[model samples]
Target chain A: MKKWELKPAKDLGLPATERFRSLRRESGLVSTGMQLAWWSMVRGYMAVWHRLQITGKHHIPVQSPFIMVANHASHLDALVLASPLTWRLCDRIFLVAAGDVFFETPMVSAFAAGMLNALPLWRKKCGPRAMGQLRQRLLEEPCSYILFPEGSRSRDGQSTGFKPGLGMLVAETSVPVVPCYLDGSFEAMKPNQRLPRPRKIRLNIGEPVSFETVANQREGWVQIAETMERRVLELAPRRGA
Target chain B: MSPAARDRLFGFSHAFDNPVTLVVTLVVGSLLLLAPMLVWWLAWTGRIDRKMKSELITRYWSWLVITPLILGPILLGAAWTIVGIAILSLLCYREYARATGLFREKAVSAVVVLAIVLRSFAELDHWYRLFVALVPFTVGIIAIVAILRDKPEGYIQRVSLGVLGYVLFGSCLGHLGYLANDQNYRPILILIFLSVELNDIFAFIVGKLLGKRKLAPNTSPKKTVAGAVGALVLTTLLVMGLGSFVFRGTVLAGPGYLAFMGMLISILGQFGDLMLSSIKRDLGVKDMAATIPGHGGLLDRFDSIILVAPGVFHFINYFVGVGADQSVHIFTGG
Candidate 1:
């Protein structure tokens, strides 16, 4: 006889307020339904408003346990990056959002967790422990993440140097990190803008790269970050073209 | 629909027509009013510490909110009572699904949810035949819907979990709603809810005072044999005293029959509590969810009522049929 596997929800014991902010939070039927509806609406809005276009969509791994790292310029960066993926993967995909911006208030936290299906990354207080938890979830739940390697959105349109935190999640693991670039998002919705403009947006996805040989140390993390940064930057259009 | 059926479904004027309903309402109201004074007295005597005092007050506040939500619907009419039960069924199933990891099977969950809605419709329409048929019908649908995933692995587990969820929450709890079909449903439901909740309190108090031996410690460590026996005696007596009025002039009103019904409520209520405990032990979860302040999930608060609902429902149904004089198929007339 085969023993049955019983896995309780990871965030089962937490209070309701804390559950929304917990990294271990898992969505049930209601939250999943909400996310599906929210994402579907967002997809429609993006198509009509931004005239969103995608290139190299085939580069997205058919299965999960992968990471999608893109340049962050606008609040719509995560939405644009996630819009092209199949709806079947909606529940398993978690956007690693900024905790302070997305999760500080109760209403916003609910929106982020319930609608966007985002997991918080506290940039100010984040340490290796938080990064380690994210890494473990990616490989164990075999789920995918949509993260911004630049850590935070750029003040100006120019891209910033990729932070080493991105390497902490995928260093020396078989998990593939697919580099992506978002063009015209800064023009559409800058960090200071309250509402997004009706500018067209383009998403360029590059082939996935793995860091299995790289050591799980600071130097290796920095190296992986630089390589990913270069790959994403290369996908962007020429500066003067 | 007949005028009598309309009166039972939506008429609030007759909410207190039954003396038993009036007494139960007064008793619950008095308890809520006196609880704060009792807590203050305990605090003054230094019998309970500050933390315990605050916890007790928090629990009392939660009950204050919960009592009105429960009694308001029953007072309004049977229609609202059925709707309330339907919502409770969905929330309880949600907690169960999340705890058992069955929520991951979206297909099976959708089938279970659809079955619950259908069962609610049956109850609302007062369609007894369809209400009874839904149990097996839903189990079959769950089995079929689970296969659509095309993955045979864990097929039995998923199907079994879905069936059990539907049976426990959708069907068993639905019986409580179905009882509203009775013309005297307000008093009957109040009696059942009051006794079931009191049964838990009796066990706790008696166990604290005189309990020595463990009663299935592995299943529920805090439960004692003395507590169970004490509750069985007290609750049976409570029911015998109160149930005579609720079941007046019916076959169930006899002393012997009422005593038997009381014992059934107490025993089955204990079993229901233990059943949820066993599930928690299996899943290694303490409480289902932190829904109610100081009381854990709705399942945790109302676990005793689940089994007691069906057990007491059928017992009365057998002796003197439930809703015998009330109009049937009120919404879906033949």
Candidate 2:
């Protein structure tokens, strides 16, 4: 007879706000309900208001343990990148957001964790130890993540260089990184704007890139980030020539 | 609701109608009042160190909050009592599910929760038939719901966990809520809760004084055989003293019957405590959750009452049936 497998929740004793920011966070029955409700509302809003269009839905990975990296140009980048995924997968997918903006206050942390199902990336203090914890959660839970590699949202609606910190997450793992580009979200909701405008947005998803062969080091991380950046840049629409 | 039913449901003026209720309330109040002085005395005499002193004080503070939350509802109305138990069932199930990792299975968890709520509704309606029927019906539903997953792997584990959760939290605890259907529910509930809590206190104090041999070391390391025997004797006496007043004119007022009921309360109350300890030991957790500051969890504090509720209810029920004269199906009007 096989042994009965019984494992308790990782974030057992932590309070609500602490659970929200915890790297060891795992969704339970209540949070699953919350995610389903929040994601359905976001999907409806994106469809009706943003008139969001996706060019390559096939490129989205079928299972989790993957990363969706998009060009960071607007506050809506995370929302737009996450909008196309199935609501059934909402509990398994987490949007990695800035700690300062989304998790600095208790109220914002609650909103981010409860509604968005987000984990904080403390950019200023994201040492190797923190990155290692994030990596551990990804592979261990085999969950998916949605992140913008350009660190912060763009003020002028242009994609910046991808940061090498993205390398620390998937440099040597079998998890694939899906490159995506979002156009017109900066106009829809720029960093300076309080509310989003009803501007049409287009999402272009490219094939997933694997870095299993790359060494888990500074040079390998930079190369992986650069390659991912170029793939997202390729998805942008051609300009008049 | 009928006038009679309304009176039973929301009548707060008759909170102290029964002599037993008045006596139990005063005793609880006096204990709470005198607890601090005792703690201070212990601290001043160096009977306990700083950590033990702080833990004892913190536990007292938690009980201060918990006692009122529980007693207030029963004193207010049967409706409030039923609702409070329902909330407790939910919270206890929440802790259990999270600890067992059954919360990951959303479908099974939802079914268990729904069954608990529906059982509470039956209690509130005073519908005895529906209340008793919920256990098997829910067990069947939980078993069938897991088959919907279609994966067929770990189906036994999922179904078994769901059933265990519903039975312990929903049905066992629900018996306490169902007792409120009786006309004299306030005094009866107060008597049972008071004795069960005091049972734990008796065991702790006695064990500290004369505990040498361990009762069940693997299951509960701190429990001693001496503590169990001591609690049985003391708690039986307390129950008989209170039971005589509560059942003054009934057949249960006899010495033989009162002694049996007292023993039942102590013995079953100890079993309940050991039962939760075995569960925690198997799961490899110290406490269920840090819900009550120093008490570990609600389950930790109330474990003795879970089995004692039904045990005492049935024993009294066998000799002189409970709620036999009271109205049944109060809201259903059948």
Candidate 3:
């Protein structure tokens, strides 16, 4: 019916839903009133993004929890991604951030740890040692998570390749990852750009990619990354497209 | 045995008419009145940082919407209190266990419920000793025995830790129940509660009426020396006058003593409040629990109670712990 509805159906182009299943991923956010307050603020911030309007939000099940993954093109990616999910999920939620950057500042650290549900990704601390506990946190909490598979910011305003790290996370948790693309945020604020333009931005979220569907296919990682890039390419500015 | 059993179970509410109990309650209460003012003074004088705000909305929702409309009257009244208290204890225990991660693998809910039930016995004098024994001993044994089957690692150590926490945080606090209807005990409870109440009341009125200086700009922005004074004044009045009602005029005291003790309790009550606030700041929890819509958890309500109980207990003992007739019904709460 609406862009929001179509976007969820297939627009973001994901390898499999499990690649970004929010529930199957680790929940590092603490649910607190302060967090809930900040979450609402983040939602408002997303609405002002290109005047985005949500529809058929209920297509997302009220009871069933899912995983959320999106193409990270700008700093605003987490807010835009977490916003729609907040409107849909209505419970404790979180996003994965680099432990080195987000967890370093006291204020940001408090916000991340307090209730925004931030999980830290460290390149140095790779493998099961990290995956095992993240897996446990997911099982223990009925929370949804938002992850950017690229792990770092993408320059030149395009979705980067999906790293094996993301696929590894998919294998361990086996949760659905809903691939989403930002139509205007890359240009709204890109690499080396300290500020955003007043132009309208659109975020297209796709149905989840199931890990079960992609687990055996090792080649699926590049295919998944390329698929995410292709979907965002569809939503890119007409000139960028 | 039927009447005898019921009689043993439920003692009629009682009080004392003595010099010792009366003086103790008065002096302890008097100091409570002065506490908030001193705190306000510090905040106004730029000593304690005005870092925190009242966050009144959250508290109002808890007290007005949840407690009064849903759980409060039940707790302070008939039939519902036992269950209310159990629920309260459970939530408090949940917050603690979840925060500390001490009893990570154990079912804190079931354990809290069991502890609450056993602790309830302490309220009934007939089973007081049993209540104390149930926690550190009986529950301890049962938990150890139960865990034996699982053969959990550090079996004895885990059970001991769990039982100790349950006893300290859960059951030992049950002594609040013994406070219900006892006159001798009521003096201390009343004085302490009144003084703490006075802190909020006088601080509000005085701060509004005459406050000119902010005590602690960084720690607590709104507090003032004037507000602290207001709290002290109100508590002194209660210590000298409201107490007269409790004593039926027999609890004699000079106005000077009343003023002096009132000042003391006012100070202590404020100390208690600040202590509670500090704990919340450390843990980063707005309230102890979300159960009470406006009031907060039992910990929140009992924040000052922890300090007031022992403070006024000794105060009542010193003031009203005298005279033949007064001692007759002392523990009986006659």
Predicted model with the maximum DockQ = 1
Question: In order, what fnat does every candidate score?
Answer: 0.88, 0.70, 0.00
Best by TM-score: 1
* Candidate 2 local lDDT, residue B279: 86
Q: Report, for every candidate in turn, its global Cα lDDT versus the true structure.
A: 0.93, 0.88, 0.53
Compose the digit string of candidate 1's lDDT tens values, residues B69-90. 8999999999999999999999
DockQ for every model comes to 0.76, 0.72, 0.02
Please give, as one word, the docking class of candidate 3.
Answer: incorrect
Candidate 1 is graded, for docking, as: medium
Cα TM-score of candidate 1 = 0.98
Write down the TM-score of model 1's second chain: 0.98
Residue A45 of model 1 has an lDDT of: 94
Off by over 4 Å in 1: A239-241
Alpha carbon lDDT of residue B17, candidate 2?
A: 88
Cα error, candidate 1, residue A29 (Å): 0.6
